[model samples]
Target: MVELTKQANPGGLGPTRVLLHRPPALTSPFMLPTTGESEQAATGERGRARAALLPQRVFKKPWPCEAAFIVNILVFVYGASIGWMSPMTLLLQSDKSPVGRPLSDAEISWIASIAYLTCVPADFLIAYLSDKIGRKNSLFLLSLTSVCCWAIKLCSYEVWAFVLARALMGIVMGGAYVTCPLYTKDISEDSVRGLLGSLVILFHTTGNLFSYIIGDLLSFRIVLWICLTIAIFHLILCIIIPESPSFLIKQGKEDKAVKILAWLRCRRETDSLVQREIEIIKKEQKTDENSSNFALKAILKDKILFRAFKIAIIVALAREVCGAIPVLNFAGDIFATASKGTNFVLTPNQQAMMLGLIQVTGSMLGSSVVEKAGRKALLAVTALISGISMCALASWFVAKSYGVDAASWLPLATLCICIFCDSSGLQPVSVIITSEIFSYKYRGTVMGTAMAAAAVCAFIQMFFFKNLATSIGLHVSFYFFGAVCMFAALYTILVIPETKLRSLEEVHQDLRTKKEKREEKALKEVSV
Candidate 1:
């Protein structure tokens, strides 16, 4: 027997009318099966048999990728801003200076290094914003900094204006690093998470290439206008994308979360897979909610979480201090020195453009193979290669300092290898692994802390790198970076677990100490 009932709709449109099946009790007169009911049961069996003969249908949703792509547009803009400095610096200090006076050496150094300093605070601020306002809203708000950055440049050619613009750009840089990874991880499925996470670096490198090409070829004002237009375009796109379903669940809006998750997965709200995923999210959130300690305190108290946090911090620092930033920032000077007494002749702008192309190429390759290669293996291999390449470059410089002659191409070749390895594996995989190892409650806090530390390392490198290279030898700096990369490789091989296609609980289980595992086993046996 079918009974009509009213139920709350999970989609939140309105009350839904439902038909519930009510089987009669054996004691009731209606318990006896009627001839009509027997006929209906036979018909249902026949229908089921016919349905089983047909092929099962599958759906492949493009919504996750589409959302990730749109959100990463801000990341692309952030990359362009970083790349803009390399070319724009040359113009600012030239005879055709827009400010009517070439910037002093001190002023130029301030402009270059100030952004890294600003990134420190912005990192933490974004962590708070991402949680309070939602990932989509935080990203939308932070994107305005990029828009303001370009608008300031267009408004004035004054030195102060340029510095302020770069400072704002730094805020966007910090926020993007924190928010984009969280947003992408929340939206992506386990199978495609690595690929989508890798897109962060891919988009960043592509933006670098965009800026290098345009800043090299276009007029100063024209490049500024183009960048501004892209920033505005991102703002418009940001307004329309869905908020993360995970964030929605946290806000007690499960009905809306279900709708958004179904839309993101391109499945029906009542689909088994969708329902299972929702249950998983709720279980995770419930675990977090039941904890009495604050997020950071909880991480500190938990052995597994603390270990994971350490891994995240170590890899993040390794990526920043691996010498890529300094090499890219001072590419022209390195190229000039490397090309001396050699037939290799290229303008500074052309050299920067070439490095940009190498970066994009490496990032693309990394994104394509990340899922297949897995995060741990890829990070270790790249870090090792980058270390070896850096050591080679150092040896070449030392050879030059002595009377011994080396191949003219050695320095450039090694530098390219370092940059390529960094983009393809070290950088992107570090980010992917960090996002994969933590639960939703602690993700923002851990990411914020790690990135803020990275920003500090980057600031130190930017401020003192040139002076260190000059005071000591460039070879000494290279050797230090090489040592760090080698250390990162060794650490990854020994301690880090493969996180590709793994859930947060699975990854955390691997992170547990042997003692912890034994204790857990004992507890399970006792319960049994």
Candidate 2:
């Protein structure tokens, strides 16, 4: 869900309006918070100190540490797709996927569902273990899991083996997806949080696109082998990357974190600058540390934080049901059926694959403009436009069946619109918003939960979509999705605040205040 601002735009293309950039360090109205890491945690402390350290704010460049953007792209391109489509299609074929035993789409759907269900609990477990030991180490372990899964799938090609491999892939992919952003946030400067956040999904989209092509469009074996090899190579990059600065500080290794920070910048920064920044971060860390409650309990108690969590989760879930997966994953079959028994010569899977790749291209562009296009504004506009497009496509199909002339470009246009909505707005927004909205202590947990919604919803929708489309009719199937988009739009407009250009603490404070107000109102109304 998170997009790397740099990779987000590929070469930086998006709305110039809501540009997400950290304000320059203050000049005259200087201020600093009094806190330490023991108080606010490393993230909270750094927020305050960085400002003080920059009397004449020099916009710190992006992460200097050895980044895994290209590798992340490879991991997502290969790892996630193995789960995305081929396996599901194989089940539908009443046979195993390109390699495995055959099962009905429904049965295979259930298998995929189970895989995602596992990711929910695994998210937090992975995070705890990653932090407890180290970020790079955790990723390395996961990389091995991916390698084994692909290799096993290549050899066994059986029903149970396929299922087991997918499940294994889910767990390892879980480690990469959850830990990457936290790791990126830890190592990078605040100025590019939005960009970094966006990267998480940019790579994910690329992965999905790869799946759409290699597994669904081209052939399962080709994609599987490609991913398997790439996963192996990515391990090399993992070695060069340093550990998270936050993790090091917690370990009482400030000197190491400092050195790594410079390394991440890939430039020789002065020690005075590093020392001053560390001191400031130390002070502010105190504020967050005193009463930080990152547990589910604190999340539930904090209504606004909880509100963001709820919305993020619901939207992530709803986005799946947008019928996008069903459409993209099963479009070939659906087209054949919708053709009224016609052979339907066109390749639906190939088209979908190409579309996914195009969307990745678009996402790369959108992320660059995140800083310029204001998060809320871009999301709202894209959602509405995309919803309308889906509705139109559904109507066009129903009309064409009734002997109305629905032109060829109609369906293609609808798909393109969906990609635009998804890559540019929905995908990036889901991860970035979730990351920015939650306090640092609670961010990983909430993101894990939110992302779980996407995984779960995707499983449900992908499996049942064919049946649902047949029962409800393709026209109505898209309509229901359109309705979901509309609802998301309304909720975003009314409740979701603009997070662009705001400090993470400022956003957290707003949530905390809203919760306090709600509590105050409840207290005033109580008679007991």
Candidate 3:
């Protein structure tokens, strides 16, 4: 049942205040209105309003948020694994280690870096599986891999055993970035989408924190036991949840999709709004089918899609190469220096904990503001601030070289600010915006391609960061990061469109209009 409504009032505060608008009522004049249509439509609208009120009366809790959080806890285990090696590396080098021989530095490097190498190819493989088997099942497969990773660590102490464990972890990493975001977006209502999406990062950071604390206090075998327990736990928990409604509809299980969507939104299957949203999903699926022929080449030829793809890749690369990981890797050394000659200084492990706490806090803050402040604004503000902070840190390092005495706390403060902005702003925003911009037809492919690029960039930065710092200076490396952030900020203001609470078609339409306007302006300037 297609219902036409009036368009929103132009030239006013219309777009920000409401989701419903009264656009022209018919697709065309040939479809004339029938008798009794007006009364039926009015009755349906009231029913939708009543349905919206049921959640307030009965299910006063956010079930979707709870569900998303439950699924994302697996990410915390991944984080713990990432943080696991830091302390474990030191312990393994001691004579009291489980293997009975200290690991060489070259072996340790392979253990740390192998997951990333495997992740590049796994991105495409996992993405294909995600689209083929379904999101829920893909996640179940990821948990199985997670279990294998931890189990290998539990059962063996050989150098090859550890390397194999880390390689399996690479599959988990790829699935987490690809499948988790897509699943979270599909299951969530738009109102809480950003909040729910940010949970992935929040849980990951929390897991890292847990690893640091638990690895410090417990024996090596005990830490392995706990990590193994988490994987098995999520595998069991994910078994009970319903498959995504989008995937259900794609599979032509319309009734199941309706039931799942209704349950997730706390609405009745018969409700007009529920039915309308279902229609939208079905319509999108049909569109995807029609456009499936020659999709890869078409994506390259379509100007708007290509532009959106460019933005997504550039932002993703920036998120990785902007020095966040390198700084986190060396946080202990930076903090060690910052605390020299200071009363309020922290030890290396203590500094790790502090940064972990800050990361979780930033994610929490980002979830809160993403809906209110909008995506473009939050990204621009954070990028500009990050750029300025990097420049300040670079200058402070330069000043200390010429017989100058900067405050001991300056580096610590600056580094914290950079971390805060990254966690709270750029990292999650890049992922959210990427998922929101494209339709489902191209969503999985685009995410996989972008993540692959990001993985390569991350690999280069992780491998060569120290080498570059040695050949040039550390301060110059930071200056390069600062320049990148400034460029990113400029790109956001000039090119990015606000996508707050807008539908997929609406977002595409806005971008198309902007592109046309730019071309028109160019032509006029040439004529003048």
Candidate 4:
């Protein structure tokens, strides 16, 4: 008979190894194995033969990227929801409106901005749900909410119906931001975390592009059905994916955590790398368990955490006020304004589609280069570019107003640059920084609060941006947005730390003042 024994390493600091031993009787050449031993050996041989018959790659453990791709499907759906309004607004306000009347500016603003307003409350709710019910469950709930949102739109064309539908989408939007980044952070290895984290914006931009293209080509009912189908698909995928290992560990499911982490890393559960990661997660969870009950209060009390929180909020708000959302939502109107007297070749919907393509291309480039470029540098550079592009757009608008015959293509070109910069760096890097700076205990709460603030800013912009442009001139609005983007660039250079392939402690250490570091060193020496 063969015996399998697991031997623990010294101090339990290393991986447990399994040794196979034969009984003394079986060790003898003349000895015969028992029936049970024979069956076990046969089964093992068959298993080995089957494994060998298949390709080597077939047996390889799954990568975290696969999980990230699945999770970010919801993000893609959220992007589509965002893009839907761009073309749909034009359709709704046209003479052939399906609602039987042209939507008033106030009504269109409500439809466009209501989602952002509702997101504020939904952020906290999702934060709580993410901690309580687990990340995967929260995602499932959000996917269902998306389905409901699209379903409402499919069922009715009334102004109230559209507004109500957008409100439900708010819940999904708020929850997706709160949950997906945390989920991505938890599953990803430090080496590829930035790449995977950027996938959120990548998928999001692709969704936006998808929606823009389809909304232009397809009928209203068809577009709604397609979006509804996507929501359902995301819901199904959420059910199959595992809960985040961090959440599993926090819930005291160490065994399950190890299994999932091992799978995510493409290693066996007993592999040393997997064991080390599991230990790290356990340690983090233990430390968090010892901390204060209220995450918000804890953040407020700790200078380092509070600083990180502030950085997160600042970057998040910067991403929003940099004017991506309003531009995306009111793209048709912007294009119409810009092409007022120009020989522009593309229609407004086509122009918006072009912007969507720029976003996807930029997001892909960003995801590919994020780890190499590092978060801080990419964000600063992109913000600077976006600011420049916005300023150029404003300049063109100003020139046109003064009857200066600048090249008509200038606005389209500058808008493309702005959208590209946004997807490539401003949006994704902000999200990556927010997810990387905090531990699991504080991640959900901090992210929720920051996104809530961002939602408020977005709501304000969406509600009043058109009016603001009308009243103060589009040039003024562009200047304001450009200024904010420039500020974001400055802040990134001055304040934000490089988080690429870095640990939370290392990143937080960068945030500490020199005086605090000296005081900490002195305290350590005294304790010694």
Q: What C-alpha lDDT values do all the predictions have?
A: 0.86, 0.65, 0.78, 0.85
- Number of clashing pairs per prediction, in order: 0, 48, 6, 0
Minimum summed lDDT over a 10-residue window in model 1 is located at 29-38
Could you give candidate 4's per-residue lDDT for residues 108-219 as a string of tens digits?
A: 8789788888899999999999999999999999999999999999889999999999999899899998899999999999999999999989988898889888988999
Q: Taking the tens digit of each residue's C-alpha lDDT, what string does model 3 give over 1-528?
A: 222333345586456433342212333321222222223454576545433433211222445776687678678778888889877887888897888899888888899888888888988888888778898998899888999999999889999999999999887887788888888888888887877877787888788888888888899999999999989999997887678888888888998888777667655566576688899888877877756454456678888788888888988887786667878887776565445556867766777878888888988899899999888898888888888888888887788766477887778777888888888878888888888888766777778888888888877887888777767766787788888888888888888777778888777766777569798789999999
Q: Name the best candidate (by lDDT).
A: 1
What C-alpha lDDT does candidate 4 achieve relative to the native structure?
Answer: 0.85
Ranking by lDDT: 1, 4, 3, 2
**Model 1 / residue 321 / CA error / Å:** 0.9
Best to worst by TM-score, what's the order? 1, 4, 3, 2
Candidate 4 off by > 4 Å: 1-61, 100-102, 400-405
- My TM-score estimates for the predictions, one after another, are 0.89, 0.76, 0.85, 0.87
RMSD of each: 10.3, 11.9, 10.1, 8.4
Clashes of 4: 0
Q: Candidate 1, after superposition: displacement of residue 170 in Å?
A: 0.8
Check candidate 3 and list the clashing pairs: 5-22, 5-23, 6-22, 6-23, 7-22, 7-23
lDDT of 1 by residue, 451-523 (tens): 9999999988888888889999999999999999999999999999999887778888898888989999999
Ten contiguous residues minimizing lDDT sum, candidate 4: 29-38
Best candidate, TM-score: 1
